[model samples]
Target: MVKTKIAVLVSGGGTNLQALLDAQREGVLTDGEIVLVISSNDSAYALTRAAQAGVPAVVCSRKALGSQAAFEAAISQALSDHGVELLVLAGFMSILSADFTSRWPRRILNVHPSLIPAFCGKGFYGLKVHQAALDYGVKVTGATVHFVNEVPDGGEILLQKAVEIQPGDTPETLQRRVMEQAEWKLLPQATQMISEEIRREKDQ
Candidate 1:
């Protein structure tokens, strides 16, 4: 099927990564095979998930590597080793430089926990995004899957699903809701969409 070789970059609990694994198990992710997982933290739970799924995983800790450049270099080398064709940032914490993004162009994807252009960009991640949405009194918050570019969260969006903000929603509650209703579903869908695109391009 010429499935796209995918590498998931993660930094913490890999709920999103687990979603991709589950999608593959159920045949929802037909055009993409998750070949590797690269984690920025050595102790991240995502590694355990990857091990259980039998996916090869590696860690390139920013602190242990001692610099962002070295950390990225390690990740680049691993991706090269695996011949990864697509990169997915699933709760990945590092900010990739322009040099790195340029190397992959539209081949990188990120799932941000917001509708984007809303509670995104610098200082917007994890629970902070949901807190910002609640602070602004927004009735709806969601997730956005986009192509990663130089700017933070400033990439061409691929998909988004609006999750309603409840009356008594806290940041934790809202974050969970967004993941349940949006991130998990959209990440796999966007992955398949891009995987199919890559397969077609490769065929031609």
Candidate 2:
């Protein structure tokens, strides 16, 4: 079977990207190969992670591009050039425009720190989502993997795993637990599922 070419977009530490890499190394991502890693920040550690994994990494700084259209165009061009069949927003901070999302359709996927329709959407990212969940005193909060649409975090849900909110859990500890128990497990599983589906479609 031909492996689906995957490109992961990141802007920060890229723990999720590392999870994918680890999964690939362990033969968990059987139907997909992480071909490229793109960073919106030039100095993002994700680029270093990609380098260590021998995956091609590119920096297309949104600030340097100065316009959403130009940045999206550059990203689209990169995806095209690399023959990327699937796009994963691992820790990508920039919000993609409708033009970009529409161009790829359901080919893009994202992993949110919380269940969608809760601590998601605009202004909720990274630690903010976990902070909101803890502030709200929710007994349960976890990770979600979904298809990326135009709206932020407003995508078709694929997989979600709930983590029990401990009594003494702070945002930091909760975030770490969620990444370990949920994001790391779900992202790779969802990616493999999507890759297998894409392979089946091609075979048909």
Candidate 3:
């Protein structure tokens, strides 16, 4: 069987990226291969992790490119150069250009911190999500992995796993638990689902 080449886009610690690598090594995400990693921030730890894993890691900045479209053009060129068949947004912070999103469509995937359509939309990310979840006093909060659309965090539902909020849980605790869940299951499962979908489409 042919391996599905994947590119991971990240901006932070890249715990999710590490999880994908682990899954690949353990034979869980068997349908795909991580061909490259891209980080919007040059100093992003994800880049270091990707290098350690022996994958090509590129740091491209929109600030340097002058416009979002130009930045995306650079990214598009890199993805094509690396032969990336799929793109996964682990913790990528930037709002991608509409042209970029359209070019990828269902080929791009994202893992959001919340269940989405609830705690996700504009201006929601990272600790902000956790804080909002706690502030809303919702009994349950979790994660959502979805397809990428023209709008940020506005994508077709793919998978969601809810994590309960305990009575005494703070934002920090909630965030920690959520991150743990993502590392252990969500990210790998999301990637596997995308890989399987691609495999099925090809098989047909």
* lDDT (C-alpha, whole model) for all candidates: 0.96, 0.93, 0.87
> Using alpha carbons, what is the TM-score of model 2?
0.98
Count of backbone clashes, every candidate in sequence: 0, 0, 0
Candidate 3 lDDT, 34-77, residue by residue in tens: 99998999999988899899999988788878888888988989
Local accuracy of candidate 1 as per-residue lDDT tens digits, 18-121: 99999999999999999999999899999999999999999999899999899899999999999999999999999999999999989999999999889999
Model 2 misplacement above 4 A: none
Q: Comparing candidate 2 with candidate 3, which one achieves the higher TM-score?
A: 2
Q: lDDT score of model 1?
A: 0.96
> Could you arrange the candidates by TM-score from highest to lowest?
1, 2, 3
Would you estimate the TM-scores of all the predictions? 0.99, 0.98, 0.95
Give the Cα error of residue 155 in candidate 2, in Å: 0.7
